[model samples]
Target: MTQRIIKLGEGYGDVFELFTLMEAMPDRVDRLLALHTIKNDEERTSLACIFKPTNQGNFHPIYICLEGIPKPNDQRNKRYEMFKALSEQFDKPIVEFTVPPSETYHEEEQYFQQIIAVLRLNHLLPPI
Candidate 1:
């Protein structure tokens, strides 16, 4: 099974696209995640949804809206509210955790690899 992060964009307006993808394929939805981090001295969150691998290709895609929304604990935002609503709508709890800021990595790929590692360690994603 191959797992990959499909970045939608920074949470800004791209968040709606993530919602559309989830709503359009609710059955394939596996998990919802809230990755929190402090960037530039501000607490932020990245919203992501993991989808089950396709039957034919076994390609597991993790769709994400990278750090753009304010951390709910620090300040509530409409985007975060929408994400919570989706979690309730899908009957899936939001698996949230604090992570090192993306800036910690020299490349975007490295950052994603760290996230994948965390997921596998927690049994959120299947181990290799």
Candidate 2:
């Protein structure tokens, strides 16, 4: 039940990389959740998909896209719009986070570790 979060940079190529990462982790994840923030929209949208379990008893990994889309206070972007459309197809609402992007972590591993720590603190991630 361990949960981890990773953020992608606001780059055109990042979307593909993130997609590939999530697709490769289907056997290790339990759920996939994606959040997209679109411009001109007052609210955000999320899409979640549940994948079949693996023969090794591993669940599909969940993925959330928190990049490219501008914050509520910032200007809108096309990436968010794309995510919003995908979210609708998944039928999940995108949730808003009050916390801004972390500046201390320079590596994706560090970012994921921080997210895992937060999930553990909130009891959202299983203790291992």
Candidate 3:
């Protein structure tokens, strides 16, 4: 199986679109993830929607709104609230954890690889 991170943007206006797609295709939705991290001394989160492998191809796509939302425990946010509600509606608990700051990586691809590995180890993503 092949897995890839399809970044939408940092959690901003793009998160609403992620919610819409999740509502539209519940069947394709595999998991909801919240990656918590401390960047510049502020707690932040990255929300992601993992889709099941494609029917014809072994392509597992993980749609993400990269680190932008504030962690509820740190600071409540409307965007994060919506995601929490959406997860409840889908009956899937959000899988969350801390990861290295994105700035630690020299390239976006490197950052994605780190996230992908974390997902795979947690059994959230298929192995390569």
The C-alpha TM-scores of every prediction are 0.96, 0.50, 0.92
lDDT of 1 at 66: 90
Predicted candidate 2 versus true structure: per-residue lDDT over 15-62, tens digit per residue: 656556545653443434443444344334333333333456343233
Checking candidate 1 for backbone clashes, the offending pairs are none
> How accurate locally, in lDDT, is each candidate?
0.93, 0.46, 0.86
Q: After superposition, how far is residue 1 of candidate 1 from its true place, in Å?
A: 1.0
Q: What does the lDDT read for residue 3 in candidate 3?
A: 86
lDDT of 1 by residue, 23-111 (tens): 99999999999999999998989999999999998898999999978888746688989999999999999999999999999999999
How many pairs of residues collide in model 1? 0
The number of the candidate with the highest lDDT is 1
RMSD of each: 1.0, 6.4, 1.4
* Model 1: CA > 4 A from native: none
TM-score preference between candidates 1 and 2, better one:
1
Give the C-alpha miss distance for residue 49 in model 1, angstroms.
Answer: 0.3
Badly placed stretches (over 4 Å) of model 2 are 1-10, 16-69, 72-75, 120-128
lDDT of 3 by residue, 17-125 (tens): 8999899999998899998888889888889999888888888889988886777784568998899898998888999888888888999999999889888788877
Give lDDT: candidate 3, residue 118: 81
